[model samples]
Target: MAVTQQLARVSGAYITRCRASAAVSPDADPEWDPPAEDWIDLDWSPRFLRDACELAGVDSPTLEALNYALNGDASVDVSVLSHPEATGGFGPTPTALTPASVADVAAKLAGLDWDRVMAEIPADCRETIAGGDFSGDPLAYLTTHFMALRDFYVEAAQRGLFVVSWWD
Candidate 1:
């Protein structure tokens, strides 16, 4: 139960379970390898964002809020604050993010109290995970990867690009 969330699982090889990529469009074809420059593939997972916000005690417009905007369906014209379409097809198309809708997500992330959030990270993990270095300052390591997610979203928003999250 200690490491029940995705953020807690992130460490060394475990992080590879998830990928966040940025591109000009939704690149659905698996054979089509996106250029390194256009994409930001990370070993980070979605759970990190959610846990980071929760650690700092943030309730309003938390990580769940941002995920809805970025991971939500663009074809459906729903309100920006609405929850993402949880019900969908078997393929990755349902969770794919688009360039046009990024600005709304960026605005939401920009409003977060990053300082307080960063300060909440513990040096040692409270969980009993057997691998990786959650020692000394796990939050320090966690925030490093966590911030990358924030930057990825912001960069995609500025350049009008799209990012998709998935795992094999």
Candidate 2:
């Protein structure tokens, strides 16, 4: 089975459920249940994840440092192009994204040199991408998909909401 990456916006109801779930014992709230559904699905392929992560302005020592500082450590960004799982996001999860962090990601993504990013895609990753319809325009593909991801984060952050991203 192929493991495609998935990102979703976490609703307030989901957050409430999470808090309640954590606060209450498992046996207490028979009606309470862990969140199992996603509200906003930003479906991104592993190859896209790989390339976006390495985007010129998107990947920098300073940006990574800030991200690490903002978000603790321990959320795995699984390997897309033979890369190891990345623990702790600059934003939140795989679990959450803050207003500030979402803005940061948007800014970073907007300022990215998409051409440079696509040009830098590793050989193995390129091979993987070649298997799909990614030959048209990498930057365009990234913008279309990443824009959705960015917008989801921005909107969620603005509403004091959180977005949970995980892949199964």
Candidate 3:
């Protein structure tokens, strides 16, 4: 069956389940009444839907169904709210530091013995780091930084250090 059809079927099943689980009025038409907004509000984001699908090991058809349930036919952008906390806890936590405070943090990080960590990076990465090409080839610099951070994380983990989870 097509993914869209499968999704629709799954959605039907979900609605059926919801109706069965709830007390229905005999004279009331369940199909005529849509679910409450709160029902849809709970974990209805595209990313949440995608993650749920992945975790449930749902097939493409089921995933399509899940997507349809969340937001019908429209292509949802999961990256819409990249930093939720930045919007005063509605998203990500806002940065407590001002520009000067951020600069101070950067200066402190710069003073650390990063040379030893950077030495482990491959030769190709060194060129990108040395060039400081933040505008062009940001990925190259990001890759290098990611590796360095990964290495640091591994070392920290080995020592049983607690690392806070943060999405890149």
Candidate 4:
């Protein structure tokens, strides 16, 4: 099964509610909804971005930012927000980035050397992307989703909102 990544910008209060609800019943499937504009579906681009970041030797906040964007930063954990079925029983649970982490990631993404990274992707990960292979124009695809993810973080940071990431 193909796994796709999703990110949602939510308020601290919402996160608190989710945590409380999960604590009450860890197995309950509550309706987890954020506004349309607050969410992004990154498809498999995060894996590509993370791989590209690694190949390019992107460091610290930038590298960490991409990693967190794909896999959560562990700022908050709420198991009820995800289901094993959604992940094909082999994917990460829903995890969040606090507003502070969101701000930090936004700043890091803003300073990322995208051109350099993009130029190095083919040499870095082309035929060795671990679980799967690249399709179409990897550079263009990664660029589109990378920009979207970066913009999503910037917006979330500006609003002082938390970001929750999951795979489904």
Candidate 5:
């Protein structure tokens, strides 16, 4: 089976509910299906995006923003991704980011110049990218998903909601 990544903008109340559910039932189901409007289905884009950013020498908050975009800050204690029996193995735990962090990341992403960043990717990195798991134009793929992710963060930040992400 293929593992896809996703993120959701959730209210504080929802986080509390997840925590309560986990505390009351350690064997709770691990399937997390946020409302369609609140979810960002990233497919298999994060790794490619991160690798491209690293190769392009993307710096500081931008790099950090990309990192947090997928690997969220583990602020909550809910084990929403752990279901050994159902999944046959333990997936990554769902992690969250506070509204403030979401805003910070949105700002960083907004500040990035996509074209310049693409041009900055070193030749060796391009070679590595050509040999990567993905086909076609990796930069184009990253651009599409990066825009979606940036928009998602921007909306979440505007709503002052917590963002949760997981791999499963």
Candidate 6:
């Protein structure tokens, strides 16, 4: 069946279920209450699953196996992904961030060449930087470039040197 047809059928069933549940609920407030039924069913065919997995940049077979392990009809022994050291995985996972590491990150950021870095950044991001929006609030630009700059910093830190400059 076409995806559109499947989606329409799912939507219709969802609406019917919502109306039925709402009718039975005692304190159903139209203003702040959710529509009674929230989830819609979909056929989990291999093609559909595979497309979703590819879009998410994960292996389809691995994701499918994980799903089955998590929710298969017959219960089986399973190990869930968890970090034992952190409560609700809220605290930091163990990793070495020594004084040398701090010095390295600082040195790498200080030594970076603004011209070369600006050239390498995406055109849209460079435009944002050059437009002076970041001039008044440097943190905004830092937040945008944080991931990219961190990667660059890691490589520079490994080599023990980097470059830096200012634009006015």
> For every model in order, what is the number of clashing pairs?
0, 3, 7, 0, 0, 3
Instruction: Report the candidate with higher lDDT, 1 versus 6.
Output: 1
lDDT tens digits by residue: candidate 1, 1-168: 121211011111211222221112253212223345544433433455566666667766566555654355445321211112211122243234555555566666766767777676454533411135344444555556556656666776787655544322
Clashes of 3: 7
Residue-wise lDDT of candidate 3 within 1-168, one digit each (tens)?
111110111133433443453336443223322223211122112343244235434456544433433333222221221233211114331112222322332333333333433444454653444334335543344334433433433333333332211121
Query: What are the models' TM-scores?
Result: 0.56, 0.51, 0.22, 0.81, 0.83, 0.23
lDDT of 2 by residue, 27-78 (tens): 3331322243434333444345444555434557435522432231244321
Local distance difference test, candidate 1: 0.45
Error of 5 at 78 (Å): 3.0
All candidates in order of lDDT, best leading: 4, 5, 2, 1, 3, 6
Clashes by residue pair, model 6: 111-163, 111-164, 112-163
Model 2: runs farther than 4 Å from truth? Answer: 11-14, 22-38, 44-47, 52-94, 113-140
What TM-score does structure 5 among the candidates reach? Answer: 0.83
Q: Model 6 residue 99 lDDT? A: 26
Give the per-residue lDDT of model 4 (tens digit) for 1-168. Answer: 576888889998887776566567656534466788898989877766887788877886678777876677754765667655322334666788888988988999988978888776665465554335555766777788889999999999999998988877
For model 2, state the Cα shift of residue 60 in Å.
0.8
Q: Write the per-residue lDDT of candidate 5 for residues 34-132, one digit (tens) a residue.
A: 578998878888877787778778887689888987888876554554555322343576678888888999889888888887788886676456345
Candidate that would win on TM-score: 5
Give the runs in model 4 whose Cα sits over 4 Å from its true position. 19-27, 83-90, 122-133
Q: Where does candidate 1 have its weakest 10-residue lDDT segment?
A: 1-10
Model 4 is weakest, by summed lDDT over 10 consecutive residues, at 83-92
Whole-model alpha-carbon lDDT for candidate 2: 0.45
